[model samples]
Target chain A: MSGTPNQGPGLRYPSNKKSIYDRNLNRTKNAELSRAAFAYLFIEMIAYAQRGVSNVGDLEQKLNTQGYPIGLRLLDLLLSRSSNPLASIRPTRILPLLQFIAQTLYRHLFGRPADALEKSSTEPGQYMLFDNEPMVSQYVSLPRELSSLNCAAFVAGVIEGVCDGAGFPTEGVTAHSVGEQEQGKDAKAMWPDKTVFLIKFKPEVLEREEILGRGGG
Target chain B: MVVFALMIISKSGGLIYNREFHTGLSKLTSNDYLILAGSFHGMHAITSQLSPAPRIPYITPQNNMLAPSPFPNRPTGIEVMESSHFRLQCFQTQTGTKFLLVTEPQQPNVDTMMKKVYELYADYVMKNPFYTVEMPIRCEKFDRGLDGFIKVRG
Candidate 1:
């Protein structure tokens, strides 16, 4: 896999040191990763993060922190790997940023777009990203003692990291288990792992979004 | 020489996993297997303490980013046990999960196989979010991966 940097004859460059920057992220944009492999690595990451933690809350926090840097790194790689003609332009508005996450980022990570996106009815600077059955939380059955713990907090951290990296500067991002209540009791059996990621942006971010909206950037 | 069986023992001397790959040896009852795992765990602890390696003093330079530890502490225990018919290899991870692979006596490159198994365990078993620690592993993906690796190599 570690071929020559520039696509040419396979010439030996033994003396030169290879750097991460020298690699092309765009080439692997179409490449698919094994779900099992990803799951295993993710599980190990959770286990590793769980070490030296007191409670489930702390464990979730550790997982979130672990995913934060990945989100930051992915932001740059995703932008660069975009096939769109306007790929160079960063997402300036809240809607576009959220769309980028829901459609583009979600597709790259989980091989599908997010289920739904909505704005808060009563609250300003608040957006909701919904997933009927969040991939990360699909198999996780929390014990009664640690019922409040949501593994998707790591995913929320990733979203926060991406937003912050893209200059959104969100106040905080959190994943809440809405479960099957949203679909109502009468509805034919649906996903029990329903989750809504509440994204609350900083006041400054909202102000910037308003400016960007008016300017039509 | 080929691997006949694989077992995983939890830190508390519980038999978390037992799988037979080949029919090279007589099959032990589940109860007997559990007893064997428990006894092995106890013996491993005793052996580590019984034969302690002399400590060597070393200093790590602060500026050396490549050096993780100047004096790396090694896991002390019986690693490989060879018998006339079958050779048993024991690999205890940093977290104290024991992997026991039963192979034919003259199996070559068993150490490499053990290392590969450890890598697979770290990836498929440890990384799985649904798998509870020190519990029986029921991950289908882990089983499939192990099966594929061993089938191709064995």
Candidate 2:
């Protein structure tokens, strides 16, 4: 149905009479927002998430929740954009999906692929995605009271969303600053902002992967 | 190319967001917007089901081989509706979120506009930590981004 002649209450038109629906999505595809603007927005996000939080863990969890939906949304958006429509395909296995995240997703968001992707030597379903200098936390300097907090948990949430959205469900994804935990001082100094995203898929996902691997081969 | 309005419906047929840009159409109350979205979702489902089944390609004895189809699964819903005054274009994401754009009947590149709206939704609404899934969007950044893009470019 069309609208009445009178303007609806609460309907605020832009000064130029244009709305968001009129914008083109591809206009910003190659354009980059200013780093300062991004930093300011990120700082505001962290501040908003930090309010009324008693513990660093809770604060990080809030940030993670914030990033989770983003990851989910990005999964579909990136998948559609990366492949040609005629031969479009999505990652069904673990390795290819992880590669998609470490490469395509990373490059899309950060302008660089992740530093490394490593499976845990001891854990069955755990994989580590490393970013040498997480852009999200590049300017974040935690005070002593919240020294344990890592803002990159937001990014970790994104990884978890990608994994979960791709149908490879994960138990949880967490971000940890590994720079301070490095064994050698030289290593620590080299990448002080190194953050590792630990992705642990659910047991059922791994079990399905094993079954598919055996049968498909 | 005037855009009359935009409506975002969640996967389950709930109206999550609705905004009007131009005054070309009759004004509907908020409740009316919900009804319009729900009815449209239902109509879309019916229309999709009404689509004819894929034809069975006959294989001649001399040409028995059928190469796999290159195209992905086709969208099975009503994508565009046109009236004398306005046109409605729907863009449905893989996750089933629907972006509906009401534009002038002769408007060009409505699909592109829908995609851009979807992107804005992804960035400003979905990425905002405070926004709950399937909820009404009240993100300020999305509004500003939408205004800036549409006012200047649309």
Candidate 3:
């Protein structure tokens, strides 16, 4: 520190500094990122989370926690990029919010929309977003003992984060690989990385959705 | 392009990484490496400030209204040092972390190789939440990446 001037870190900042908060998210709607870079980063992220964890489930949870904050941050970034950036126009109902995640958010991050969206007939307030081959989990292959592990847990965490940030708290979001089952039944052999993200919203979110619906009447 | 070794010095002059990609160079004690990193960091800081300012006084109070300057960012520090045995190249990132590459003397384009190393460090080490800043980087992924990168270069 002797040769350097005694100035705060702020002085090092560029004079024409631009804040990420001030940037328009929608401007890069067509931008693309290198898949190799993304895959390598995701691989390292998994390896980092795998350290010191006792079981596969703990690894999944760690990945979830890591993805949670990203989800929360992306919630604002994605919503603000919409044609209607106003918070008042944000999706208040479950169906629209699910569509936003499945279509809008998925398209932005993965370059393509999620494969499908379905609601559970037996369980109310439960929705599922399906990805025939979730981009993040494309190269991940679990051993037989850890076959239960799904790398898509990180994506589920992001979804959960987005939901929680948008005033729709959820019971939990989980990822289940349906490749084996779907390959046999649905004959979707190409998508061996098929994953389903089950999002179970809290009871209060449903009640709020109903109340919001009534108020709009 | 006979590269010898790579060393990463933390922002405050600590030795976070020292790896030898090619053999035949004399090795020093770990403590000596630390001292070398500290002194280099100090020298870098001194040299950065000592850079000759351009004669044109394009910067002004109302700089925002002006067109973007064609000049690149300010020179950070001593980029290259030549010796009979080896040539040392330094690349300092905007955040103050420095990467030093030791290659065979007269090796061309060390700058590009150093830039690639910096990219790996940013992705594998800095992005990992487990990596505490200014501490010795023990990330396995970083090591693997650095190894792979050097291998590809050769």
Return the candidate ranking by TM-score, descending.
Answer: 1, 3, 2
Regions of candidate 1 where Cα sits further than 4 Å from its true position: A1-25, A185-189, B1-154
**Candidate 1 residue-wise lDDT at A214:** 82
lDDT of 2 at A153: 95
User: lDDT by residue for model 1 over B1-154, one digit each (tens)?
Assistant: 5789999999898999888988647879999999999999999998888887757545467445565654357646888898898899998877788999988898898889889888877765666676788998876556766888889987
Question: Isolated chain A: TM-score per model?
Answer: 0.83, 0.85, 0.84
Docking class of 2: incorrect
| Model 2 C-alpha lDDT per residue in residues A42-140, reported as the tens digit of each score | 877887998999998899899999999999999888866654564247788899999999988898899889999999999998999998889886555
Interface RMSD of 3: 7.9
Q: What's every prediction's RMSD, in angstroms?
A: 11.6, 23.5, 12.6
Q: Candidate 1 or 3, higher lDDT?
A: 3
The two-chain DockQ for each candidate, comma-separated, is: 0.17, 0.01, 0.03
Question: How well does each candidate superpose onto the true structure, as a TM-score?
Answer: 0.56, 0.52, 0.53
TM-score of chain B taken alone, candidate 1: 0.87
- Any residue pairs clashing in model 3, and if so which? none
- What does candidate 3's lDDT look like per residue over A1-217, in tens digits? 4867555865353346666655565686458888768867886888889899999889889999989999898877777667764642667788888888988789888878899999989999999889988877654545456778888899999999989988899988999888665468545555666889999999999898889889988
Q: Can you write out model 1's per-residue Cα lDDT over A73-184, one digit (the tens) per residue? A: 8888888887776965788788888999998888888889999999999999999999877778644555456677788888988998899899988777888878555667
- Candidate 2 similarity to native, TM-score: 0.52
